[model samples]
Target: MNGVELVCPAGSLPALRAAVDNGADAVYLGFRDGTNARNFPGLNFDQRGAREGIRYAHERGAKVLLALNTYPQPQTWSRWTRAVDQAAELGVDALILADAGLMRYAARTHPGLRLHLSVQGSATSAEAIAFYREQFGIQRVVLPRVLSAQQVRRVVAQTDVEVEVFAFGSLCVMVEGRCYLSSYVTGESPNTCGACSPARAVQWSEGAAGREVRLNGVLIDVFGAHEPAGYPVLCKGRFRVEGRLGYAMEEPTSLSVLDILPELLEMGVSAIKVEGRQRSPAYVAQVTRVLRQALDACHADPAGFAPREEWVAALQRVAEGHTHTLGALERQWQ
Candidate 1:
């Protein structure tokens, strides 16, 4: 257990500023292309923006990690390699990457540059992490959201590499790097095109009874007159199972680990990541502010730490479906 670094997401320059200003120890961002997972339109950074963001973060005594975390096809592999070069040239503190080929390129070409295994790499076990560290000298690994706190501790104890876990924001129900649900509907996925539930394939319509959300003409979910609506990601939608109608995979809920800050800190996690690169600067500010307060409180008194009501309320305001869960951190949630 040590002082946990608060790593926040910065999809844009303004979001990066918001995260740093709100007390982030480090900020992670992606290039404005298919190289990063959050390659949504109007999000992420261009070359100039990435340079400016790194300068801003460094000036403020915060670190910047560039994400080249997508799986690139053979035809598009050069783009990913070029992005690694760009990140190294930009003086990023580290590069979060998932592709083995690109990882090798970065490690071999820029021996001094730090490499972090992206969650999309799906390295949950100690052996998987050790392999990456041995083969490519990966300094850190962002664990997928499917592991429990105990499982996380086991992985950490077994590896010499630093471990980073998601603390807040949207939850992906499926295992990272293997999810094909979005691809099945939109013909694109985070593993390939760098986005699941791409905006271009999403459609919303009003029907006589209620509202409807469709992804590539496939019905994702339907909302009643007064029910809340959510993004049409395939996993978060409703489905019928055994003649019962409900969310078959998972509901549209954000992950909030404020209550378990002490457990994570005690587990010796290197960093606590906030997962919202596609969010606005305002969202970044609010989330960072709350988590900053909580983490500070936990560091001051881990044994007696309690989540503040105001912090929970503030996070819930921006939570998807107006609900938050511990994700797989709590055994029951798994």
Candidate 2:
């Protein structure tokens, strides 16, 4: 196996620096608006901050990919277009985008700027990827976390474009860019507003039994006295079904593909992306460090590769609900 690019998330300037300092090959981030996903309070960069981050990453031999990965309504189209211009002006290594109109504008207006299809595009098939590559000149596609490794290998075999896959962090059970559970509850979603389970609508209440988590005043989950509490995202919460209470849609767990590093490398994946821009700088640093070490180990001896116990422990310490899953990389998840 050869060296696979390690792309880390940077929700803030500090996170950007931490990723670069911790041996990330590239750092992808979003602006402080609806143009990108992970639009959370006190996170994401502004124009000036993004420019500084690009400079910082370049100085450290790391590339920065600016994410304008959200869809835009008719009224918001100009803002997304202007964001593309601003990203090019700031010297971003590439623009990660999802909207076709925005991609067309970027490709036609600034032909030299590299384009990457965000996972939000949800292009799982070679035909869909081919259309983007031909129409908008997307150089790479970030595959959604919905395919098994064998399926991913098939996609790679069918496409000439570079492929990137999520390797770690929170898992979105719903298909990227199509989830409406948050919007149904809060009138906001990642596709339009670049957020799910918006902080404003979240509420936690302690009770005699334990705790209750709610989203937009709707009861999502109730925790036992000794059970661990999690975020009130509608999908990951436990609910009543058939007179029994349990995780109905999905559980509160993160995706960790550390064990499949060799398989990804062998499949000729161009990059492995870490997906936590809403998390803190410490989280970014620790995750990047562990992934960096794992990547190095795999590249050194692919056949002998194995996940380190310490690496797993380190990631679990920061994982949501203190649990992780193989996600769709394994057939069982499908």
Candidate 3:
């Protein structure tokens, strides 16, 4: 466990600056359009924003990785292509890409640009990583958050490309984010639209001593008077599984790996990515700063590493729920 880079998320220009200011080794963001993953309202960088963000990060001794992670539609190839060209021209440290055609184009057009395989491609195994590396000259691969620390070590041993794993943030339980559950119910594709349950699809109806949460005309969840209601996505619904109503996809839990950083670093992971580009700038700043401090302490003495419980607790305050799981860090958590 020599040193592990902190790869954070930046949804907007202010968030980008916050991430760098708080000690993110690298920050990944998407464009304002659907070309990037977090293509929601009031998020992502425009062309001017991206240029300034790159400049800001570089000045602060941090790198900016542009995320062109979404797959392009047949008629939308030109939009995605131009984004790749602009990201390279703006001198992003690397381009996190998923589209094969765009990767090939970048490899040819901008020969010096560094390419990283995105988890959206669902490349969990070493063979898939190798295929991208061999074909498009990918230098790093953000492995899907579906492998345990031991499995990460196996991947590291098998691939020449540097491995990056998500260590914290939203625990997306839908098979490395190959999720169509929400789109099926809400008619908005998260993969292309960057919105899971589109704001327009959700409705709250008062029920008997509770509320009925609906999505796209379907009943998602019913919250009792004492029960705290959450964002009613279909997957998080309490369904009848094995004759009992309980969470099926997963109970809403943020992934926390502050205590398992040593295992990831020992597994030879090049970087630990913190997911949540949709979060606020304050969220970005606090998480980056605390994680950096924790990583610093761990690097100083691995055995002496004691996670800052207050910081971890602060995270829960901003978290979507009270639950936190080491998503994929332990295989059973999957």
Candidate 4:
């Protein structure tokens, strides 16, 4: 199988360089503002940084995808439009967008700029994808992490656009870009604010035997002495289901598709995406390197490349539960 392009994450200029140097075919990133999805403190590029990053990645024959993927308020159209303009001015390889108006603006204003449909729009069906392709000229699409490889193959056979699927990093059990757990508690929406469970709202209260993980003062989870606590998002927690208190939506885990590279390639995907932009540069470099190596191997012998246990060990250092799953890629969902 011809393995798909390796599209990795770059939360900072240094991370961008690391991803490229470590063997990424393309790196996806965002500006510091709400224009991108992974808006976190001390992460993301400023305007100047993005320009330099584009140059840095392009010089190495790797592409840079600028994520303008957030939905805009009626009054905040200006911010979104300006970001699109800036990405075009900086000569980014593509703009990953969600809003229809923003996509139209990009196509009309920056005609030469390439358009990619972000998963925020929830373009799951072939019909939905075609709508964007016909209307806004989106050449590529970041498919939501909700399709089986078989379902993905069906979508690809039906649409004319290039498909990008997430291969590694945080698994969002809630619907992609449509979660409201943060807003219900903190008044900040991921879709509009480009943040989910904002960092400032997270708090940990120590108890005699353990700690309570709270979000905006609401107790979402309680960690026992033996249990470890993460950043305390509303989702990805142990909750009650039918009187049993355990992980309901999903457990804290990362999605790993290293073993399924050949299947994804056989299904005709265009690129593989790694999802952790909130993570460190070291995490980015290591994951990119392993996937790049796997991809290189798969191009030679499709069935011969099985991801080593060491690669999984390397990934588990940053994986949410110290475990990984094939997730929707293997149809492991309802």
Taking all chains together, each candidate's TM-score versus the true structure is: 0.98, 0.97, 0.95, 0.96
Per-residue lDDT tens digits for candidate 4, residues 1-334, read: 1458899899998899989999999999999998888888899999889888988999999999988888888898898998888888888888999888888899999888899999887888899999998988899998888888788889999988999998899987766777788889998877878899898888888977588888888877888888777777778766777899987777888898887888888778899999878888898999998888888878778878787777778888878888888888676464
Per-residue lDDT tens digits for candidate 1, residues 1-334, read: 3488999999999999999999999999999999999999899999999989999999999999998889989998888889999889999999999989889999999999999999999999999998899999999999999999899999888888999999999999988998988898889999998999899999999977689899999988889988978778889898899999899999989999998899998988999999999999999999999999999999999999999899999999999887999999899998
Query: Model 4 — which ten-residue stretch has the worst lDDT?
Result: 325-334
- Provide the overall lDDT of each model, using Cα atoms, as 2-decimal numbers: 0.93, 0.92, 0.84, 0.86
Candidate 3: stretches off by over 4 Å: none
Question: Model 4 lDDT vs. the true structure?
Answer: 0.86
Q: Model 3 clash pairs?
A: none
Model 3 scores a C-alpha lDDT of 0.84
Residue range with the least summed lDDT across 10 consecutive positions in model 2? 225-234
- Candidate 1: residue pairs that collide: none
By TM-score rank, best first, the candidates go 1, 2, 4, 3
Give me the runs in candidate 1 sitting further than 4 Å from their true place.
Answer: none
lDDT of 2 by residue, 9-65 (tens): 999999999999999999999999999988898899998898889999999999999
lDDT-sorted candidate list, best first? 1, 2, 4, 3
| Number of the top lDDT candidate | 1
Global CA lDDT computed for model 1: 0.93
